[model samples]
Target: MTTQFPTPANELDRILTLSDFNVDYSNFDDQFKDLAKLAASVAGTEISLVGLIDSYTQWIISGHGMEIQQTPREETVCQYTIMEEDHLEIENLSMDSRFQEKPFVTKDPNLRYYYGIPLKSEGHNIGTLCLLDRSAKKLAPEKTELLKIIAEEIVNRLKTYKTIELLRHKVTEVTDTKNKVVHDIRGPLGGIIGLAQIISEQGKDNNMDEVLEFINLIHKSGNSILELADEILSAEKKTTVKVKGDELNLRVFREKLEKLYVPQAKIKGIKFTVSISPETETVPFPKNKLLQITGNLISNAIKFTPQGGNVQVNLVLTARENPNVLRISVTDSGSGLTQSQIDNIIEGTSTSTEGTDGEAGYGFGLALVKHLIDGLRGSFNITSDQAGATFEVILPQ
Candidate 1:
């Protein structure tokens, strides 16, 4: 590569990492295309590009009169341009020691004149907004300042894009959590009501043992429903329903979830399974929040899932990152959600939809669950396809 110039050892790696968070100008809107065109015209050059220099290649995100999308990092003037503290304006590439023999200057368009300004974001130079031409040229001192301003504008947009993405992720987490929590209450409440009626009507004829059994069932159902409520409510609102104090363990947590949803799944004719990793250590989590998240997830998975379909709960320790990760995932075989449904839910514009068994929901359970998770300093993710949906919660411990 013609005795590679004085490039920083780790600079390209850093640029590649930063590139992931920003927009690719290739698919960028017309405004950016217009910027590239303006840069070319103002510089009196034949070509211009908003280029992102990655670890291996130089990617052209947007430009005017730039036919190729990318080039070898060793071949472009923008590579050195990004390293400069300010604009890098070479009046004649063939006369420059570093770029004289570079293919970009000696072949094809044989580019000679180059004017570039590093695109900085979050204090790091990620790439360059550059003007190029085949003929010898010089950017006036006035034009150099203008190019720098345009480069700064591009950095501002990149930062804005990063902000929007984070917000969108948060919205989706809350929306899905809301959907699950809202759908949970109906099953336990319905069981309690139906059991109460059975006990009332058969009091005179049923044996004492049968009567006692029905009472026990009713009591269990009542407690389960109350726990669900306590979990769904906020920490302040939680006190209004009930008080819970216990650092939760993985084994007991999985058992509680199974106890709450196994019967409900059976009633709906769905196969339910729970798997707690044997390797999981005894880690402490707020029990109330734990129950609330899992209970809501299990109930919704069962509700929307078709009869004879399957729902599985998995609790595993993910040691891939710091603080170690506790991952709780629930998978359900149900009609998948559309992009519009997801967007509406996260955007707070969605109305509740009916479940497979004609079950109606208030539609904010998933949102509350999301809030609870956030309060716990955790992250939530979901993926749904034609077959069904899987919701994953990753918490640092």
Candidate 2:
């Protein structure tokens, strides 16, 4: 059967002009070139092109068996092939009505067999997947399907590249905003801290009650601002370390924990205890992340436990599925958290209730701890009862 293919009127005006089609390009990546070559080999064709029709020219992003790097859109047979709803294949262009009189086929390369598939994105035709051969040949039905799949893959890659470009632009905007806020905060914070120090010194000499009160208020306000700044900085920083199941010293880790929690434990009248199994010397973790996870747990334990209540921390190396894993538990004697609180710990919202001693926080500490544990590729769980709550963190060793 023979048929004549007519160009769509709407697209005729969108076609590129000859002057705008420039092909003298030199920079092209080897990987794309190799992909085009692979496609040519699979189709048993001498020439292949991963062609993209931009606003001006039908640019060959990657190509094989072509002397010129690019060509004018008006001269690009692939441009017309993209308009076809299905693969445009011909065993002989000389006999095809669409190309028998075309200048390129009659005068230039004297092309014969040609097959082109539309490279489509989101139902819009973008370009063509084309293969060329000197002699007439017909492709199997399966090969035609495979060519369509390859064209779709190319469109997927282009979409991914555009998404990454958008994310980079967003990250740059966020960084610039954070820098400006930090700069504005530093000067006023310094003055507040300095004034508080002066008031504290004056109160110490005169023993004036009003001066002492003012100094305490100023100190508390400054500390609150500093904590806010630290949280902002910590939240902005991306995770740098990858989780690996490396051994960490549990005994030494508990010692460092004691140093961090002792003062808070004293203030709350809580007795802190750390117990580790004799054989449990090391457990798998990134040391800094372990510290962050444990620190948040211990701080929460100290905060919730009432004065004279006991908080016990335990570490054990146990066999799970015949492989060693490390388990750490923090048990506190305080008003136990409700089931809802436990469920909401990983939620981004604040779930903090006032401690027995009224410790104030935005309830972000546990949320941050959960984020760190997740980054370490470990699991954490919580249980509550009348005696209090217990938190267990387990990591593969």
Best by TM-score: 1
CA lDDT, candidate 2, residue 314? 91
Error of 1 at 364 (Å): 45
Q: Rate the local accuracy (lDDT) of all candidates.
A: 0.69, 0.67
Per-residue accuracy of model 1 over 1-397 as CA lDDT, tens digit each: 1233436445524543464463432345454787888787777889888877644346676789877665545557777876787778899999998888877878988888888898876556778888888899777888777777778887777677667656755664574476566557767676786677677567667667777677767867776776666666544343323322233567766776665567668877999998887765454433435655666677777768999999999988655567767889999989977878766644546655556876534354465556667767988777889899888888875
Evaluated against the true structure, the overall lDDT of model 1 is 0.69
lDDT tens readout by residue for model 2, 126-146: 577799987889998888877
Question: Which regions of candidate 2 deviate over 4 angstroms?
Answer: 1-31, 95-110, 197-397
Error of 2 at 35 (Å): 3.4
Could you report the Cα RMSD, in angstroms, for every candidate shown?
21.8, 27.7
